[model samples]
Target chain A: MKAVVVGAGFAGSLIAKVLGDNGFRVTVLEAGTETGHDEAVHRFRTALVKSPLAPYRTTVAAPSSDYLINTGPFAYSSPYLRMNGGTGTVWTGITPRMHPEDFRTADLGRGRNWPISYDDLEPYYRAAEWEIGVAADADEQRQHVPVADGYAYPMHALPRTYLDHAVASVVDGQRIDGRELLITGTPQARNGVPVSGYRPDGHLCAGYASCVPVCPENAKYTPRRTQKRWSPHIELRTRCVVNRLHADEFGRVTKVSYQRYEDDTTGRHTRHEVEADVVVLAAHAIENAKLLLMSGLANSSDQVGRNLMDHPALLTWALMPQPIGPFRGPGSTTSIDAFRAGPERATRAPFRIELGNWGWGWSAGSPDSDTAEFVAAGLRGYALRKAVADRVGRQFTLQFEIEQEADPANRVTLSEDRDALGNPRPSIHYGLSDYVKDGLLAAKRVSDQLFELLKADDYTSYKPDEERYFEHNGEPLRYWGAGHSGGTHVMGASKHDSVVDQWQRCWDHPNLYAVGCGSMPSLGTSNPSLTMAALALRTADHLVSHRAEEVRCTMSKAP
Target chain B: MDAFVELSAELTGFSAEELRSTGLVEQYAELAQDATDAELIQLWYTGVWRGQIPSARAYAEGLAWKAVGVAPPGTGAPGFGSWEHRPRRSV
Candidate 1:
């Protein structure tokens, strides 16, 4: 069957490839543009000072040439310009799988259950890891689950660094489970060890916070890389923002309409519409819910844009006696999961927390610029150079993104004001919940314990009270989301409380489905993008199988 | 919404527990449900989501006043510029 996908992020882009490979005609509508090295850099920088999306602004009169800034929820938060391949362009290339406990979060009464069980999607997740060329270790990965013997990992796991040893020195005997819970090294999607015949690009692991902005060394595996390998049946429409999904009387998606934000810096507008037998909403979490609400579909439960979830990133920092060469490797090389799996010092409920070894104990902006500031501070000329020197090799930072259980009252809504396309901008109406407070309280205590054990000097924290006092834009806004929001159109076994079924199909409209993190019920500690991609693969497989079943049934009924 | 109310009260130096008992959570939930645009509700909730709130007890009082049709006791009304800013967000 011919399928249309909205979004060019990890999920949408992958769906296009999978469907095309499976002999299905595919059209991928993306709300971003494609730029080569120099041009990509220009847009990336512009978005930093301006908006992450300045290349494709959808409107009625702008020509399809001007770069537009995406005002969509998660996409707007970073000002990350959407280019040809999507957000994968600047991703750190860290590939991880959701823990088995993540799947039963809600069911255990601890978190929430997915519409589909882990067993149902496990194979697809395996297939996706293979297709994306991940490098996870079988032994380290199966810590929580009974992973089958010899579970294949596509790429070789990256080598653990010395930083792990340093961290272990600090928390080696950390008490948990009547013993020490050793913080182990996780895997990365970056080419490790070396693929045979793989052309080497850059050094293995350079601490580049720019991974989210620009990977100058080309070590990242963005969707653009996958698109290049796809069959000829795949098509991409960039700089286009899908406006609505039109459905036929039988509840089948019939057409997809979008406005191309090709011109805006100067000002001209254009629009386009395409028809497809099936439509999948792969736009990131907030936008996915907004589109469903705007299009008047997938909200029979009236919960389409409710229960919004995101990782509450609390920057737990400590002033170190010496710096740990934080800028020497990938932004996140070593992490502390001493309290990642559960509540702090509590027996019943389990939550997740991890150490963050990126940037520095302080803010990490552009390296060239930040280094100059330090130099200007006379760090080298100061008599207390040793004081600054003391900061080296001794700093320990831990950023904990605690999971917030689902609360339906928190959600998204359209604003009175409209954007360039006259579509109401998504006005995020979210708040931390008591459940989150419980998690954060545990996180704070655990982090304090970690800091004390590491012998770190207290520096600063991202506590709620601190965020409240900080001010900007002449208003008091302190809510921070990881851009990893979800649960707007949650998946569940029944339609009474959910919009989609286990397979992500619309309960009211069987032919329609949404295959992104938006359907996730809870925001686990891990980033949801990789898992979102895996789900897209699962959805593609389901669509293919269902189509085959229909064809076989039709043939059997023939005279 | 409870997060925002508590956060707002915190900024204004109100007791956190008092922020909870003030029916702010219940009222905010009502506002979300009554909001016309599903997306706007999301934006409003971000304030709640991040626990970002106006650092003024008066802000909560103003919100309360708005709900009850009473005049706010603080400077001006509960205007957007007065309470709409996230820590890093610009006007």
Candidate 2:
């Protein structure tokens, strides 16, 4: 059998690996060029703006700027990289599984319920954790999320930062809207102590504190790592932008069409076609939706590009009473996982409060701005040194990543604007629902209480001129994209509403499967990458099983 | 460059020995051409010369990390579990 995976992201790479292990010839097509760890680290350090996409190279053939064209009230500013590993290359590496209640949001009088329960995906989640080499204590994780009994992770949890300890000192047992605010070590895809004979591939996390754009130690798990383990049967073609999927009369994807860019600078490319027994679209949620709309396929329910979602994060910063040793470890090592579920979720969306160890960098530009302020004040010598130490050492930030319900109005559509390959750009119509805004309000209230308990000086400010700024309940509010995009091509039990079934196979096309976060019905408060990997693994198992059954049927016919 | 280092020490509040330890006094002196004392101070602190950063090493050796009393992020391998305790004073 032949399998074609259009995208070398986490989902696509996992799917391709599974097929290759099953003795199928798998082809993985990527839109971006391969970037090495050292090159990315140099790029990140040299770039003027250390944005998440700073490390990755952007080509003219697949222009990163043309990734999204927002045509809505709110700007969808969550930029993704089109690289060998996709956005997983620059992810924060947190891999918390979605709460069981998160699967049934619609039952709580809001959002949409997932077709599959957490129980159905539990084993797959364990498989994905091992595949990604997640470092976390399953016992602590089980406090919030239900996992199999005595199910330990591949590695022990990464050590929590001093800032986490300081925050926990003040607010560990506190309550917010009847939910206890407990600081738990975030389950991350970085190396810790190996367990169950599962050793991580790269150097252990050496506390680079640059996990966003680049991990110098290669400790964080990116899809490129999975690609490295692929067998000879699996082939990876870089700089190949898969634009369209050709389907047969029966609506089964038969061929994959793409433009292979020869040169990175010039828009030079060659058109290529590859026959496939099955096609899996693991391109990002927005990209998958755009591809489906452009091909005029899998919209039988008219829900191909609808029900978009993201974790709109509200940042709150403050100064600790003492030096918490900020900007030392990972960007975030712990989070308040309490607010992720409760009865309050019925009226408002749930959220996760990430404890940022990187000080005021995300909010006020950190030690740079603090130094600039002191210099402007004409403070020199010992006075300047003491001021900076006192100020920068005590800084910390709390990021409230609120869940966004599936709103069909907030969708991704094709624009008249075309990329270098003449493919239509993804035009997004995104906005926060009232339920999400209510959740933000509750988060702010909880933050205020936590700050009061910690006795820290709050320095969070929301300016009206900001791009993500808005007004809610006569109060100035703002949110930034957590880069957790999902729900564009949602999955459901019935084909009447969702584009993909529970197996992530398009109902309109049997051989076509649209996987990744795009298949999620409701993006929970947790990061979507782990769940996306689990779903991809599940789909890969199904495809392998289905192929085996087909072979058996053919054998029976031969007799 | 000696004069530049002395001025940087005075402005940044680091001793001349500490300033020389960074080994970028000459490179920074060249990059800070015609820059005011304040601009030079900002360059030493933020590792941003004019509008652009000179190099990755320059950023890692920025005086700001010293002032903040921690190694520059993504630079030194501080070992695992180093962040669990308070950082020692770099200055």
Candidate 3:
């Protein structure tokens, strides 16, 4: 059987590799061009902003900017890179598992509950961890995340930075609400202690301190790496944008038509069609919803592009009373899960506090801004030396990504604006609800207390003039996107409320499946990539089993 | 120009031709802003290759100061301890 995957990102890459290994011919169509690690590194070195998305789109060509078109009261400032590896290429590499309480959000009186439970996805999560080469101590993780028995992570946890050790010392064993606070090492995709004898240029976190735009040392795992293992079996077609998906009278996806860009600069392209037995849409949350809505294929439930969700984060930065050291390790080495779940979540949103080791890189430009300020003050000689040392050493930042309830109003819809290939751009309408605002206030309270405990001077720059700013307890607070997109084409028990089934199969189309964060009914406090990977792997197993049953029934009919 | 290309080729494992193909010469020149590519590459060879950066923060601070024409002390030359301190190709 032939399988057509319409993305080359995290989910698409994993699903395609699994299907190829299962003896099905897999063809992946990527909308972006194939770029290597060298090009990404070159762009990163020269970038002015140093934002995660900055390096990927250095050229202002039409095809480069065709990916996202934001129209909103709140700007979607999070950079979404369109490349062979997808947004995973620019990810911060934090790989925390969703808590067990996350799956039963509705049962616990929080957000909507997922169709599948944590137990159902536990084995698949283990498989994903091994496949992606996650570096984490399973024992340590069990204290923070819920882990099943007989499942150990691929490698030992990464070494905690000085900043991490400092924060953990203060927060460890401390009780918040009802549960004890644990600041443990973050499970990351970046190399720490490699389990797979696979050595690349970027083998381990050499403390590049730049995991956002690109990891200089190829230590991080991207879907693009899997293409090497599954190449002979899987065929990847870059610059092939699958715009239209066709279904037959039986409501099964028969074929898909795509536009292939020959030259990105001139907007030149050729149209092609391909037939497949099974079609999977593994585009990121926004793009997956946009593609389905544009194709008009799986909208029988009218819930395809509704209920968009993201882990909306409130950024808080501060200065340590003493030089604890910053701007040394990865983007974030550890986080506090004290506020992830509790009795308080019933009236407010739950949250995870991510402690950044890269200092004020999330808020103010660290090292760069800190140094510039010293220079601008006209301080030179030994006085300048002492001041720069003091400021840079004490820099620290804390980011709280609060879980937002899936709301139908915040969604992705096709706009009148068309890209180079005439495909409608994804127009988004996203906003924060009172549920998230309450969570923000709770997170703020924790931040205030943590500053006092750590003896860190809070330097939170909450400007009152910004459009996205909101007054919380007389203090202006602003929310930022955590780049964890979810809930656009959510999955549920039936077609009445959701677009996909528990197995991520489209309820309207038998052979059609929509995978990725888009299928998540509700996003938990942790990053969504790990959960998305588990779901995709589970869907891959289901498809192989379903195909086996089909072959068995066909043999019986041969008589 | 030839000396800079030769030194970069020796240090970064990339041949002079390969460095040219990546357009690093042009990029390095642009980053140096006013300084020639030769001066910038020489600076990297002396500071980064010789291991002069005290810390990651120092490296970033040095680069930021250099952008505005201020050079941090204890440097051999103008380009030493700049942002383009790492080997052209880390891989």
Candidate 4:
């Protein structure tokens, strides 16, 4: 069978691997550039880019002119990764699964739920963790609350660092409303304690913090890493921007038209055509939806790009009277779900905090540095001693993963503007919902209390005036895109509401599957990546089982 | 930092309108407007502006102040020493 996978990122990459392993002739059409050693080094040099960089669809308040980037009838997101390996090439891997509540979010007093339940995805998540080579620690391992039957995580957990180890004494074993709420070291895709044997996944590692910018040590697994491990039957092509996907009369995707950027130029002379029996649109999220809309191939429900969502990142940091190697570890540390499933501890709302691994003010012109300098200047000439002392340990960053209620107005549609190939680029039309804004407020309330509990001076900036300068009339809201795009082309049991079935196959074109966050209708407390990876594997499994019939049953009764 | 800003002005040699058209103009202006990116960009801008560059430690610390917020000395809630955080597992 001939299958076409359009992305080399988490899902696309993995789908290619599984199909190649199953002995199918697979052709992966990646929208990104090269993924070999030299190209990886070059990208590391220049594309150490931003914390999040992609063509997003959101009404982002322009800091300069107050012009919002995301606005309109569709979801505006800054969600694209034009590299061979996809977003995994730029992610800091902290793998926390969506809670059980996340599976039934719509029923549990929130947005819609996935077509499949936590039980349905639990096994796939296990395979993903193993395939991704994640490491967990003691309490972290136990905290996963495993739902996978007869299977645990493939790799052992990494050790809790000094900071987590110390905090565990204070927080863990603490009672939460009469029930013990334990916060443990989180599972990470990076390496920690050494394991002797090699992983079947791909590559080896030496515990490098280079998860975001391409892994210099080759330890972290980008999808490209595994795609290479497959047999020659699988053909991998990079720099191939898939402009449109065309289908036969039977609703089967038959032809894919893409262009390759030769070099030092942005022209359309390098277009190519390939035919496939099955088409898997794994182009991350945004681009896939854009392609679907551009092609008009599988959008029978007219819901190609709606329900945009992302983990609104309310990033806050703190300074310890100590020194954290700041640059030592991965870009994220431990995580807390204490506030995830339901209302967090002592608060009546839901959210989660992942420890960021960046330093207080590593970047040159960030406000974080200004704040640090302000604090240091207050201390005057004593800076020398303070700097040395503070350099030894770590400062903590709190990354709040706030849940966003899916709004149809927040969507992705074709823009009048075209790319280098004359294909219409995606325009993001996104706005924050009161649900998320309220969630942010709830998170703030929790942050204020937590800082009080920690007894650290709360240095977070809260400027009412800033809101006046930032608020927009749409939704009459005062927030910007978290830059984490999702939802567009959601997976659900209802054909009326979603474009894809639970297996991420197009409702109209069963052979057309979209793997990525574009299929998500809800934002869970954890980062969307781990869930995306799990969903990718689940979709792959569905394809492997040849169970197209089951995909029809959950068309309206999402678990 | 001031010196670097001047140097960037010199390097451009172009008029204001020219710089305004570039994405860097928007990105930089946005950085200046952003409490976080502003500090980081300004430090890096030192090279483009006047030219002297600081160490990574100095650069990171400069951004952190604005990125993280602390109660001004005392909000009566708590002092600086007792804050708590859970560390993630080592990579």
TM-score of each: 0.74, 0.97, 0.85, 0.76
Error of 4 at A249 (Å): 2.5
Clashes of 3: 3
The 10-residue segment of model 1 chain A with minimum total lDDT is: A61-70
The per-prediction i-RMS, to one decimal, reads 23.0, 1.2, 15.1, 15.3
Model 4 residue A354 lDDT?
A: 63
Runs off by more than 4 Å, candidate 2: A549-559
How do these models rank on DockQ, best leading? 2, 3, 4, 1
lDDT tens per residue, model 3, A1-559: 8899998899999999889998988999888876667766665554555667666742222243235666665656555666788988888778889888888888774557888888899899998887777888888888866787766677767777667777777878877665678787789887766555534324655666667767666667787677777846799988888888998766878899998876767567788999988899987888888889988978888888888787878888888766655555566878898788767778889999888866676687665566556645755433544555566566778989899888888878999988767878788887777888899988888888888878898888778676468776676779887888888888998788889999999999888899999899878798988888899999999988899765554355444
* Candidate 4 wrongly placed segments (more than 4 Å): A35-69, A72-79, A137-139, A147-150, A173-181, A194-210, A321-325, A343-349, A361-394, A462-484, A547-559, B1-91
lDDT of 4 by residue, B1-91 (tens): 3443443334323234433333244434433443333243343322122232222222222222211222111011121111233322221
Clashing pairs in 3: A202-A217, A202-A218, A202-A219
DockQ top scorer: 2
Q: How would you class the docking of model 2? A: medium
Per residue, candidate 1 scores C-alpha lDDT tens digits across A1-559 of: 6788887777777887878888888888876556675555444433322122332333332122122233332221322234566556655566556666667676544445776666766777677766666666677777643345767576566544334455677676677444365665555655445545344333443333344545544555677667877789988887677778887665666688888766634224476888776678877676777788788887778878887777766556665443443333344543555444543323223344444544242232222222234435543222222323334333445666667666776677776656667766666666655556556555566667767777777665333354333323233223244556678789887888888887778887766788787788765667676677778888887788787764564355446
Name the better of 1 and 4 by DockQ: 4
Candidate 1's docking class is incorrect
Candidate 4 per-residue C-alpha lDDT over A9-101 given as tens digits, one digit per residue, 9 for 90 to 100: 788888887877877789988765654555444433332232343111111110101122445532333444566676676666678777777
Location of the lowest summed lDDT over 10 successive residues in candidate 1 chain B:
B82-91
Candidate 3 error regions (>4 Å)? A57-67, A194-202, A550-559, B1-91
